[model samples]
Target: MSMHMEQTVQPPVDHSVSYPKFLWRALRAATDGGPLFYGSMTILTIVALLGANAWAKQVVHGMAVTDMTDHVSWGLYVANFTFLVGLAAGGVMMVIPAYLYRDDDMHDVVIVGELLAVAAIIMAMLSIVVDMGRPDRLWHLIPGIGRMHWPISMLTWDVIVLNGYLLLNLHVCGYLIYTRWLGRTPNPSWYVPFVFMSIFWAFSIHTVTAFLYCGLGGRPFWNSALLAPRFLASAFVTGPAFIVITLKALRARSAFQIPEGAIERLLSIVRITALINLFMAASEVFVEFYTGGSHTASARYLYFGLHGHEELVPWIWTALGLNAAAAVVLLSKPLYRRPGVLVAALVMTFVGVWIEKGMGLIVPAFIPSTLHEIVPYVPSATEWIVTAGIWAFGMMIYIVALKIGLQAMSGRLVRSDLPPAVGAVPQEAE
Candidate 1:
């Protein structure tokens, strides 16, 4: 006698919740965490508050309170902006393998990179706003209201690309997470085209930022044909390095299971890109030293100091050492396999790139001055506080967003209290 076996079918869940309810659930998930999470949030909040207070003092007293003067109008603020832009662009590295190359493992965790990009971009925008000294001046860059010299001004291009990239990431990440929460497979039509567009847009954001510096005829320090490529190379290094560290942390701290393959792929990218970044730096150094013209003044001031102003000399060397060491560690197959060593190396890489791209790149350009006057720029206490606050605020945003993402990925933050079953039809909720 043949026996017929019947498979039990799961009932179709509504999987549809109002947008406000969805948001409320997400907020709750973001706020609910263990002691370590709460402690981190508290620290970030305190630092952010302190930063806000410093910003208020700066606003009341005006830009005069800061060390920036006629010689160096741009200081710590712009340096941070430059580095964060690259960090944001570096996020695309994760997307490329996931979407373009069809790496299923990468696709599973690609949202982590996207969320990081979103936070980095937000920090970059805040950096620009703070740099403006008078926040009201931003109205001039606003479309329809302000005379944004679009097509003509590189700054205008930057505003467009940055904001556009930010929106693109927001939409893609949100859609994917929401769909996952509904336990439905994402429709490629909704996010695929934009995902591809974001890849090109990522390159554009950094390229435009590089052009912003190089287009200035007076700043010989930034007027290099290799500037854009160097920015991208370093971006690839920082972004992947950060993601590697984050993935490891997630694996250890949470129920989230990041595929070991994802980490390996990211490390491989960092290994190659770090060397490329170093090569570009070396090439630029060769050109600057070999050419040895008046234009080389900035390079000289950066590496060896000009007119006895050696404030930045030590900073640049430290950056170089950190980057070289990180690259060596990453390239060593056996060393990177060790979690502790890998995290340390990634930290070094992140800090190294931050210094290399930030103060090391931005400050020296103004040292010798256009008229050959030596006026060094130093970040005042107010600038430091404000910078720290911005960083803290960005980290808070990243941490909260990550929590929500993890919940959604794990099917814990769905419309129903019970876990979502597979193959549920996602209902459209207003």
Candidate 2:
């Protein structure tokens, strides 16, 4: 009896999944079946489309139509580009505390910071594109066909690093969000290493952005050795302040439970960075005033009257006062404890940093150009429209990202092996 045991063949497991289905589920998650989500997304889409229209006009008219003269090579767009890069890089502060310091509250909301970074970088890239004389020729940055001189050109380095950092964050954030969508806890193996790498990568992005300005020897305002540290410190202050404000908004309405001390943690970070930033500013002022020279002309114009051009003086002083006041508010024992007061402080801090890094910083640098001719650069009406449009578009991106992240956290997204019963809400951890 040849006992040929009947081999029961196990059917091949159908592990193959459809990309279209995944996308459909992801879209459903982002939509959230809520009017608020859809309404906000609709508004954002409209604004983004308007921005596209503005960009089209800019592309057709050429760079000459803008207020940027030859003396001020970089105008509003470049100034915004520089600022957005800092904002994008500043998101890393949240990452460091959450991933490295093991702050669970930060970890809960860390994705929000990453989402902000993604949107800011996207905006930064758009700012660069719009500022370019011929944005259509941007493809030249690609390797092989394009003559991007590696390591030799800082501009080339910037292009490479910005895109690389963007990719790294997208990969990490996308994986986490997607896994959460699938209702499966993400494997640390997938994203943990990338998160670690991104910390340093974030520093590099902001440093390179600083170098872009400071490396230019011709610009006295930007040639300071302290510019790099100043950039980092201000970034540390401004970025956290922005996040704190945003988190406060979310907590006020959104269902996601913000960690108990997340805002407090950010407040602490802001206070430290704010002090450092003020110290750096004082140092720069002292050196500029003490070593009076033609190079100091720009600084003189910034803080004091230069040939009766005292327009920036008032603005700079206002920014300084706001910054100091914000620092004081944050450092206050009673005020910092109140949510409203904290938000006010952060608003002041963010606004002050914006002015300091923006009009206060960039405008003065080019006020009395290298020729000593006081050729002031102001944003034209068209420039303002373009700026507003871009800003609206960026916020749109951020809002959508946050929506998706919130859906993921709320467990309403496409979950694996644990889908909620038809129309039923998922159970909360608490």
Candidate 3:
């Protein structure tokens, strides 16, 4: 018998109940009590405080406190931000699998991507703030304020799209869940705007983010049109890898059960994307190395090793190896279906892509600098801690979002006690 068939075969139990109690029970199931939730939240809060404190100190002292100099304009902050924006876009990919294809198996997991997108955008906004020399003056970007730059810059456009997209997601997701919460069917008209907006907005975030880097002509690596597409490819790979891991975690934790084929199907999608991602990376590498231009030296620095800065070389090679191994494992149907192999693929892709985006995105712009000098950067302890803290924050949000969604779907949380059918008995009354 198939896995889904086996799961659907149920033992006898009480079947009659009101929707409200069923929903309330689900809510209790989702939110009741757990050390994992409390512990993660507490750790995230402390780390966020530390990060905020570090940011304040840096602001007071000025940009001089950061490891970034004039030569290395973009560093860890921007790198993290870039990686996360791609991760957020990963949700759009989920839409393709769940909504477009009507893959019912992934229906429960789709909202997890939406929540992940929300948390990632938050972190991306934070990273940008932390990178700025005058983070306090951020109000200038707001409308009716100091200076509202128009079509002159993609950054301005990006700010608008990012925030707009974030709000749209919150509204759509909120409406869908709240309607369920209130024991009412959602209006079709309400979701129409969001469905359209989300599709366009997904392409916008990463495209504009790429424009920020590529618009700078002096940087050869960022100049290519391939950069934006590359960002999207990586986003699809990493975002789903994260979702897969979270699904596994949820399966381990609660009474909530993900049906059998769901995981293998998702893994199949991950494998396909990983292959595409690897192809894109390989193509970029070939274009850079074989062409042999001013940027070739810079590309070489990233791939093989540089004379003085050998730190990133080993890491990059390992990243390449890990990604290749992951792609191979995922491509094998038998291997990818196994839980152990599936988890390994997720880990490999996750770590590989992080390094690929982190070092790959940052280092290239610095090499063959406008000043024609090579500069090596190492993120300070403060930078590392802040990055970790921000990541922890995103994970915490995903966990909570999953909890609420699980309860809402499982008939445990109900907004009201209402009867689906009414029984009438004749009686004499005055």
| lDDT per residue as tens, model 1, 108-169 | 78888999999999999988888886786778789899899989999999999999999999
In candidate 1, stretches whose alpha carbon ends up further than 4 angstroms from where it belongs are 1-17, 422-430
Full-model lDDT for every candidate? 0.87, 0.79, 0.73
- lDDT tens per residue, model 3, 226-335: 88888888888888888778778767766666655566666667778888888988898889888987767667778765666665787688888889999998778788
lDDT of 2 at 134: 79
Task: State the displacement of the C-alpha of residue 302, model 2, in Å, after optimal TM-score superposition.
Answer: 1.5
**Which candidate should be chosen as best, given TM-score against the real structure?**
1
Q: Clash pairs of candidate 2?
A: 182-416
TM of each candidate vs. truth:
0.93, 0.90, 0.87
lDDT of 1: 0.87
Error at 37, model 3, angstroms? 2.1
**Candidate 2 residues 293-323, lDDT tens each?**
9988889988996998787787789889999
Better of 1 and 2 by lDDT: 1
Clashes of 3: 11
Supply candidate 1's per-residue lDDT for 221. 96
Q: Which window of ten consecutive residues has the lowest lDDT sum in model 3?
A: 421-430
Clashes of each: 0, 1, 11
